[model samples]
Target: LLCQILHCLLILLQLVEIVLFIVDSGCSKHMTGNLKLLINFVEKFMGTVKFRNDQIAPILRYGDLVQGAVMIKRVYYVEGLNHNLFSIGQFCDADLEVAFRKSTCFIRDLKGNDLLTGSHGTDLYSITLQDTNCPNLICLMAKATSSQAWLWHRRLSHLNFDTINLLSKNDIVTLHAYFATEGIHHQTSIARTPKQNSVVERH
Candidate 1:
């Protein structure tokens, strides 16, 4: 009877050991899964950080600068035109000139016409100066389409344009090419001038 009792105790201890081993294995698997998830998250976050700093922020800053400079120049030109018109007895108050100037000024994706008539365009120019993940100006321009340009402008109005004209030809080309390729497909309302669309027919 004593021997039988000893045997039973040994079996119980073995079962307990087996149970402990199973629990340990399950805990190890859970830890591995958590580590994998953490690693993936870190990788994605790093990629986004690199892109924002290297590409998106600079393009946005440059775009804002260019738009601002253009706005100031246009304002001066409009003022001169208004003065000339008034002097010639065109019968126009300065308010009209101010309105025209405001209309022509491109701010937050609203073009001159949009400001004048509240008829917003399908696309608006936008830029991000700092902490942007995507630096490609073309991609930024492409985002300013009929669907989301207005919303994006509303979100990013705080950005300032300091010296946008200094952007290189390559950057401009990149933007223009993107517009030509993608924008052309969507711009059915924009009729090209005959000279602009002329093509030589194959003989």
Candidate 2:
């Protein structure tokens, strides 16, 4: 009876749900309290994490978050954690690029396909896992595989991707040059991405 009770308590400690996932540069690894969000969960002791308040939470299990095409590999389920965290470092470790801008955050594969996008809220960036009727943060960007790349090219009048990229880059520079010519001082978003427009339109 005592062992069963302890097992029940362990289960309770390992779960919480519908969490807001924060894109955190400060968090060293992916973490969540909700075991329900994880697929292929493996109980593994990976030491403990100390919070800002100095409370230590034991790392209870290892799991991967599989949301649509976006799979955050090998996340740790920390006991009693209140929020889900995606680590910039962890993304980089998997050869993914993490970008933060004035109002946008993006995770892209090396081929420049966006895996996920999030909005900047105050200093924290939060992402949505599904495209439901939930406030903001919906719509996962699908990867344009090489097989489908030609379709995109044909759709754009056979305009190659490199040329499209150049056009976008040059368009931004041209706008900035115009701003400078008019003596209108301007600040630029990192990488000068025009991503905020898509995010706005989606929301």
Candidate 3:
């Protein structure tokens, strides 16, 4: 009975290791302690970071997290970082718009196109991003449709394109690429500009 209980505890620990990332408006870049989550990782001397708990961690290198067709590029490595983090500032820098409701987080391209959706936990917009190469999925987030995006939009408070520019980062490009691979066209053509063709829209 003791051995069985130990085994059960080990399994539960493994299950809880599922990456829990907080979408942080305060953080400047995506950060994670698990180097295994990164691909094409490059070793370099970056710097150090002071976590919210007043504990400090070292930033060793940077890499990309390739998921399906999307690559979250330039994720910084902070060994034993207190918590995995998604940077709203970084997302905003990439021309992505982020909005929050009571329990759902919405990410969109500037064209009002949905890119990613995350659920809100007690105090964090916890977005789980799975690593494609790993056999065990770390962060398992929901994949959404356009209607889902509109639904979340209706739930948001006073924020909108007219009021806020939203989160960003270069990774937004890879996300857009992922959408393209999935047959979701986000680009529209300019009027009277026949040379610029528009991609067909799919439901």
Give the number of the best model, judged by lDDT. 2
Cα lDDT listed for each candidate = 0.22, 0.70, 0.67
Task: Give the Å shift of residue 198 in candidate 1.
Answer: 25
Model 1 stretches with alpha carbons more than 4 Å out: 1-150, 158-173, 183-203
Q: Residue 196 of model 1: what lDDT?
A: 34
From the highest lDDT down, the ranking of the candidates is: 2, 3, 1
Question: In model 2, where is the ten-residue run with the lowest total lDDT?
Answer: 7-16
2 or 3, greater by lDDT: 2
Q: Distance (Å) between predicted and true CA of 113, model 3?
A: 2.7
Q: What is the C-alpha lDDT profile of model 1 across 1-203, one tens digit per residue?
A: 32232222211011111000001111111111111111112121111111313432111110111111222111101111111101101101212221223223212222333211111122321111122222433323224444654566465453332322223232432333544554333243755523335642211
Off by over 4 Å in 2: 1-19, 131-203
Q: After TM-score superposition, what is the CA distance of residue 166 in candidate 2 from its true location, in Å?
A: 34
How well does candidate 3 match the true structure in TM-score terms? 0.55
Tens digits of per-residue lDDT, candidate 2, 65-179, equal: 8766677889999878888899999999999999988999889999999998889887789986742223342222223455765554455465354654564574522444544
Q: Compared to the true structure, candidate 2 yields what TM-score?
A: 0.55
